[model samples]
Target: MATLPVEYLRTTRLFREKIGDVEIISFEVPVHKYFSRNEIPYLATALDVDFRKMENLITDMKYGRVAVEKLWAYRMDADIIRENKKVLLPDLASNPVDGEVDEFEDAKVLKIHVGPLKEYVRVFVRPRQGFREVVVYRKPPHPAFVRYVAYL
Candidate 1:
């Protein structure tokens, strides 16, 4: 429910491994921003971890690959508005006039589809005020996409 400004976006390429016929790679995208100490505790509590240890947990990343496993985003409860602060309504002129807007509560979380590789990767920013955690998940690639990426 808190609004934290985004300050940094980073990507760390982790090790790559092949298991049988499958390949797995890991990456960490950290987002750094500013937030109050009170907000930090709430985030820690939500993740069911010690608040006091967050600094080292994020900085040193003691949990290794496991640390990136619990990645998630909270669905926001507000409506998107325009820069003028107007409640800009949906475009009824368009076809398929479904009233509902596909509002993604967590804008920071990104799902990337690498078409050539036929692979999907999930990215999210962990709101730590001064720092946010970015995690990506790579799913198995489709046969066509695999061949496409290989050619690139």
Candidate 2:
């Protein structure tokens, strides 16, 4: 929807736990750049998420709507990702911790049940084409994806 390229959309704002809006610690990099097993370390450091967990999430997190504070259909171009970040970054920074994880196994959508959020921040990464949307959200990953949260 916007004209600016998704340069800042280094990571989709799919997470709210570690870094809300990926809380964007300035380590955000291109989505494609984070796929390789070797690249996992850099991606983990940059995003501030656990490297081992991220690797697992990346491998298993495909074709699902990761709802954190909201639901997002992964994959976007430069323009949309840019716009969403610009609008949502501020609110994400201020999001309170009063949230709940809503699990729906049948539908395959895991959501963070935070009530009454002001504004919205959603990143759009361009699909490489011929690939299903995988691990749409980076942080605050699905409960099942993380044994830590699943057991709790």
Candidate 3:
């Protein structure tokens, strides 16, 4: 099986503010686009929100708004876009489905559903391989929901 170029992995951060008192931070690392392989990590250190509270809140909020002061800070500094565009764009553009599925013996296409959203993400991976084709189709929640979810 052929290996997907390393440039496929990508990350993004989401932030929110509350009544000038507290701020919330969340980060997402897309494993295969629709289905986030990992939960968003807490980026704010001073927030009083607890883990349980935040977990419950994630279901309600997807991408709140506190102003995306920086969308891809680390990537920008690394010039990842320009460096990997040649290999990345074609792979992302080729697959349009959404969701995850089991690996097969031949080149197989699968879709993975993400969260509570009624959307599907498509992925194409090499048969019986660990890592190959992966991409994310982000459909963030409403602005207000994002703000509330950030607290989670």
The lDDT values for all models are: 0.30, 0.29, 0.28
lDDT of 1 at 85: 17
- What RMSD does each model have against the real structure? 20.0, 13.7, 17.6
Q: Quick one: ranking by TM-score, best first?
A: 2, 1, 3
Clashes of 1: 6
Off by over 4 Å in 2: 1-29, 35-95, 105-107, 113-134, 137-152
Clashes of each: 6, 7, 16
lDDT of 3 at 41: 24
Q: What is the TM-score of each candidate against the true structure?
A: 0.24, 0.25, 0.23
| Candidate closest to the true structure, highest TM-score | 2
Kindly list the per-residue Cα lDDT of model 3 for residues 1-152, writing each as its tens digit.
97643322233443332213322232343313221212322112112345444333443333432211112212222344465211111112123324445556764444443332233333343322332332223222211111111211
lDDT assessment of candidate 1: 0.30
Candidate maximizing lDDT: 1
Better of 2 and 3 by lDDT: 2
TM-score of 3: 0.23
List model 2 lDDT by residue over 67-138, tens digit each: 111123222322544543211222223343233223333222222222333212211222224322223233
lDDT of 1 by residue, 1-152 (tens): 96653322233334343535534442222212322222232234334457666433443333231232223222122222422211111111211222111225553443443322322434334454433444333343211100000000
Minimal lDDT window, size 10, model 3:
142-151
